[model samples]
Target: MEEKKMGLMKCLFVLFAGGVIFLLLLAIYPFWLLFAKVTNLIGVKGIRNTSGKLQTPVVFYEHSVTKRIVAFVAVIHIAEPAYYAAIQELIDSLKGYKILFEATGKLSPQEEQALTQKEKDISSQFDFIFDLMKKINELMSLQYQKDGLTYSASWINTDMRLYDLIRAFAQQDISLIKKGRDIDDPFTEEFGQTVARWFINKLFSRFIPVGVVLSVVAFFSRDKRVAKRLILDARNEIAFQGINEYLKDSDIVTIWGAAHLSGIEKCLKKSGFREVRREWFTAYTVRDYSLFDAIKKGMRATKEAASAATALKKD
Candidate 1:
């Protein structure tokens, strides 16, 4: 009887451990898949750490038949000012290339107001996302893409229109939105509202790192499949159409989000463009500063400011 009892206890312990492991794996599976997909699409050189600085790739592909060059300038929306400056300098150097950029073309005030109520709601949600991005920029001390990069009139915008995007989402019967609304029905409205308020408060906390906030947002995003399909896959097809039109005569330089690079690369390859060269640019560095180090840096800045003021007075 004692031996049987011991065996049963051991079995239970093993089962409990296995269950925990399974849960952890399940929780991380989506992120793991995303990482794997990115790696496979862009290779190990796509993103890397070089001496503590995170680097992103700028890849150049050459057409086999026409010999025209197509450069994919992968960019992070929020990054150091210097990184953007470096990218601008590179763009300036590519004098003859036709610039293609990603942007959801804007809607005029009249057009915006003309939108249906469902479309307006969808548009408002997008506005909320941009507002959230601005808050993140403030907390992270990073430059936004719009402020960092200058757009020339000659550059082509190869993305969907905002009005179309709003309409698309509005027309779709997205279960994620439906489910969230259902949670706010008379039965669970109060509890749902309380939970939402708590989440929003925590999400905007300064102490939370930008990366953690973004990761949490991505994890909890209602419908990843629908969002990715509309935002990424559809946009990629439009970009490819623009590239195809320009690649016949002009050398093309596409400045697009890093996530879109893989799709663009695949499209180029299918059209007989082979990657000729690749370069890595340092996007940002992770600095782990002690409290003393922070204080010393602050003191140095104060001294510099004083010196600048003294020079200005003298002049």
Candidate 2:
């Protein structure tokens, strides 16, 4: 009976250990990401630039998403230095565009404030999985850094009311979105092979050394939540960004997650927009170092503490 009890205990230990490992693996990403964000607060001193370079890949001979010739820009959201730089460059590049329609879902502060206190609380909780995501998404938001950007939630999905958002997740209807398609649109096959290839490429890249490199790049990047925040919400504004712009402007620079590019392309082509050119940016490098960056932060912390102590002594 003692031996039987010992065997059961060992089995339980193994399961417990496995569960712990799984949980840690899931969390390791946010850990490194948080570390990067924290270090960024002090600046990347002694760090040999742990960021990815900007490259615009012109892999599509035609409009990658819409099959119509439309100008589209792709940014890797989960990658470092590359993500931050691409966003600013994209914004700055848009010098005199009369209309800038942002499909990336974000908070409208003044608009939300107009709501009643109860409505405000309900509204704030819509996009947030945790309170931390809400705060993080707001701070690290990119489009708001520049003027003339509008948050148009209904551009992608017309019925995105506050209550509709709350109920969609409860009904588990989000999963069925991709499974359904535009039954009215017959030109879907123009991108069929291309979309299939893109999916397979992404799948294989994640399993290979490339994926490992991407993981490292993601940590070094700031505002990782900004681009990724779209993934969690039931409404995907990224797909509609291109077409939404097409309705108002001839020249459009749509910055969205790389994975969402194809759909945006399809939407653009359906609206008669065309891609003019493409560019590629470097994402990761082994030459960059972060050890000294961490040390510099430590040193700064000590210096601040010492100064505080000196002030207290003088007092």
Instruction: Report the C-alpha lDDT of model 2 over 114-177, residue by residue, as the tens digit.
Output: 5655444444444333333323223223222223223333223222344444333333322212
Whole-model lDDT values for every prediction:
0.72, 0.42
Give the winner by lDDT: 1
Q: Candidate 1: how large is its RMSD?
A: 13.4
Q: What is the C-alpha RMSD of each candidate to the true structure, in Å?
A: 13.4, 16.0
For all predicted structures, in order, the TM-scores are 0.65, 0.38
Lowest lDDT sum, 10 consecutive residues, model 1, at 179-188
Candidate 1, position 159, lDDT: 82
